[model samples]
Target: MSFLFLAVIFTIFTIFTYFKRVFQYWNKKQLPNLQPQIPFGNCPNFAKGKENLGVELAHLYAQIKKEGWKHSGIYIFAFPTYMPVHLDNIKNVVENDFEHFCDRMVGGNPKTEPLHAHLLNLKGTQWRDMRTKLRPSFTAGKTKMMFDIIKQCQDCLVKKVENLGSVEVVELCKNFTTDVIGSCAFGLDCKSMENEISPFKIYGRRALPTTTLSRLKLTFFSNFPRLGSFLNIRTIDKDVHDFFMNLAHEVIEYREKNGNTRHDFIQSLIEIKKSGSLTVEDIAAQTFVFFLAGFETSALLMTWTLYELAKNLEIQERLRDEICDVLEKFDGKISYQSLQEMKYFDQVMNETMRKFPPVPFVNRVCTKDYKMPNEDTIIEKGTAVVIPILGIHRDADYYPDPEKFDPGRFSEENKKKMHSCAYIPFGKGPRSCIGMRLGLLQAKVGLCGLVRNFRFTLNEKTPDVMGLNPGSLFSSPVEEIWLNVEKCL
Candidate 1:
């Protein structure tokens, strides 16, 4: 019995020693890295749900930059990750030497979760090909095609706000976006704005990785992919997968059987699929990403924009005046043309995105060994690279008084002086968000309609300095952004 106990102790010790030695990668390479603990690395607070990941990541960037390092390394759960503090290096990795670092390093197992094989999770030539096929679906013309659908949703939002004198903007925006993405992406009327408990919203909450268990599963898959594969871990919940799969199959069959057509994202995919190349899973995956990316991020954008404008009444009124003037020019109608003329509104949206970008950081993997410019160090293949978007946006050198909620910083003349890659709210280069134009259009339309019809003010329930929710993958308000709303006279 004593010998058996000693053997068990030895096995545990050997495992610990292996991981500790693996953690010495940066040390052996003579690279500066943040001190890492046994398991959580530099993300102890994040893993423990005590701090927001975006804010923590920004703090890490600030720490490395303050130390006068162009680039630094850190461990993310025993994984050696590189953080680039300089935009030049960021540009080099993202664009100039794109071939050396292309894939995002995110894990996706088509066998376990076929819907996870969307444009975002795809890598190499598959991603390139998928991106090429989907490009035409999001063009300026295609966005115009869906503007009327968005406008209808905006009308619903206006009615909903009129009925609810005071409400939490996040939930309202979520409902609006649910309807918009439902119609535009999948050609279904979700009716979330009218119905308080829509299936899409209910299933969305269950499927979204916002809960503790879901996030842990996501982290497990991301950090230890081999183990995840062995267990057949799926990114999406099984019930949610079944729900989407059935709905997608139903929609495709109905369209094919009736020969009916609609100018929506799914229709564009159907056209592509008719070419006999893409499969049903491919169609479902792309549409799911469209809904996921479209609904939440755009909702967050509108939420933050309204929150900022509510706090800054002068900016709010100015924007309202501009929105009103533009609509009057188009005969008091919200159209694609009228929305374009609201330039200051656009500036406000840009600033909102800068301060609270939907995606806090963009990641890339070194696909080939590449030497750092003007340095002896070489970033070996398989190294993870992080471009800290939030950190760069808040940098004093880039945007003075970065936290002051200033929209003029995005003015045409002011923007001219900034670095090209410095303000990447939607990221930069070839791998930038394919749905940017659509996102902007939806956000602008929603905000314009809201501002033109109603007034929003911060309610007493709102905290003075609300921190972001640590659980949210996106930088979202920790609590409900309660606001008093009144119809504009």
Candidate 2:
């Protein structure tokens, strides 16, 4: 018993010594940084599920801003991380000096988690090559080709919402986006709008790294990759992996056998696969990412926009008027041309992204030792750098009355006054979101469909001050946003 007790004591002491050294990293480098706590470091709030990672980082950024530091250090568990508080540093990291911070420091064993090999998680030359190849798939011409699919999904959304009198908009938008991404990305009729319990929806919810155990696993993999590799951690749940793999394979096989093809993302991957450049796993991983990103990101954006519009009746009325006028110009049809012409709608969407960006933070890892621009401090290689979009967006300096929902902030004259880096809803630079165009198109279509056809008012059930779900990586309400919807047509 004494030997066992001594062993435990020695193990704990060793861990303590290691973390002590790790936490001293920024201090040794003489960089401005927040002091870290033991074990959890500066992330005890996130670890305890008291706040989401984004909110936690935003609070840290606020502290750094209050101190008037351009940037500050934070610790993700035992790993030393950098948080850029000033817009110039953020621009340097994400844009001007992007080469030094090219990698995102996120990935799993592609052999074990094939779906983890998608563009979002890929690193180095593989990422560059894959991004280049997939570029054409989301080009303006391709988005136009996919507009019809979105139109059909919008029709379904309108039909459903017409009957939904006072319902949760998140669920409604989730269904609409699932069907839209399903048809456009996979040529599958997910029928999420028609069915309450769609399998795609079920798997989609499970696919997000939102649960406590999943978040813990992700944190471990991100901070201590070798340890994660030793344990062979997967980025996806097993069932989600199997579901997408089988679905992609079945579709690819059918397309090959029947020589049937469609103008969709899956068809683009099929053509690549035929050239012997990508494997079945590659196709599955790419399509899975398409489905997951397409559905959730746009759904959350639309839901939040609706929530904001519901709270501000004047803004909703003006937006609806603009949408209606533009649709009239295009013969009451929601077309690519009509959607683009709705300038006010565009501004509203921009402001929505500003206030509640789907990705509240952008993360990258330093690949080479980088000197802090014009400073003697050297950000060592392998350090994680985070840019808190939420903090910058809500900064009173950037946007006057940051808490208020005002689309006029994005007006042509107003946008010119702000620095380019001040607003990065889709991120900025070579490694920015590749599917941003498609995401915007999807969001515009869904929002236009609902706001033009239905009048939405905030239900009493929703809290006046929206609370966020602590577990979600993407921004989500603590609970459903129920809205009272009445058909306007």
Candidate 3:
């Protein structure tokens, strides 16, 4: 009995000592930091779904900013993190001194899950080379070729909501985007809008960790990437992996055998493969990421834009007028040129992204020791650097009356006056989202289709005060945004 008791005491003492040393990281560096609690550190109990990581970071950002710090230190489970609070510091990290912070802090085991080798997870030279190869695929010309597919999906979305009195816009938007990305990236008719249980839709939800077990797995893999990789942890489920991989193989084989070519992302990958630079698994991984990013981020952007427009009826009407006028110029068709000409539409979308960026925070790992400009602080290599995007977007100093959704803030004159790095919905520098143009086009096409055809009003089913989904890693609403819809006469 005494021996067991002594062992327990020794274990407790060891753990306490380790935690104490870990918690002193910021103080040793002489940086401002929030007090950390045991196990969870400064962050909330994210594993238990107590808070959204993005929202929690935004709160921390606000706290540190109020204290007048240009940069601050934080902890994610005893891991020391550097957060840039000022625009200049943020700029330096993402753009000015980018070479020292090129790789994202994404965690996954590519050997266990080949699909994890996509651009989002690659590091150093691999990422740069892959990025160079894929850059042309998202060029304006390439994106324009995929516009027809987006338009077709938008037409389906219009039909889906034609006479509905009330609709959950979030689900409706997701269905629209799924079909768009499915056709463009996978070269398959997902039929998500027509069929609720489409395989693409079902598997897409499975890819994002929403459940308790899945979330736990993500947390473990992300915080302890090296250990997770050593243990061969698989974040992507076997069924989901098989579904996408099989689909990719079939598509690639059909295209190669029949000399079939389509103006889509898959075709671009096929061309890249012909150069002996990419393998079947590489193609699958790239397409999977394209599909995931193209669908979810665009869908959420459309949903939030619709929700905001519903609340601000005057803004909705004005945007509709602009859409109608631009389409009229093209004989009632939404061409790429027409979409670009809708200046107010751009403002509205920018404001929406500002107010609710889909990815609320972005992270980078320091590749070499970085010294803060005009400061003695040395950010050691391998340290995690976080840019609290949501916090910066809502910062009152950068954006006056930050809570109020005003599209005018993005007007030509207004935008020029604001700090260049102050607004980075798609991020900045070479490592920013490669598919930004495609994603924006998708959202714009969907918005023009819906706004010109239907009038939306916020249904009481949606909460008055929107809250982020605690279980989701992305910035998503706590509940489905239900909106009453009526065809515009």
Whole-model Cα lDDT per candidate? 0.86, 0.87, 0.90
Q: Each model's number of backbone clashes?
A: 0, 0, 0
Best candidate, TM-score: 3
Higher-scoring candidate on lDDT, 1 or 3: 3
Predicted candidate 2 versus true structure: per-residue lDDT over 301-355, tens digit per residue = 9999999999999999999999888788888888998888899898998999999
User: After superposing candidate 2, which stretches have Cα over 4 Å from the reference?
Assistant: 1-15
Between prediction 2 and prediction 3, the one with superior lDDT is 3
lDDT of 2: 0.87
TM-score for all models, in order of appearance: 0.96, 0.97, 0.97
Error of 2 at 164 (Å): 2.4
lDDT of 3 by residue, 159-235 (tens): 98997999998899888889989999988899998888899899988988778877766667766788998887778
Model 3 lDDT-worst window of ten: 39-48
Residue lDDT tens for model 1, 290-404: 8888888899999999999889899999999999888888999999999888899889999999998987887888888988888778889888887889899899889888888
Candidate 3: misplaced stretches above 4 Å?
1-9, 45-47
Quote the positional error of residue 367 for candidate 2 in Å: 0.8
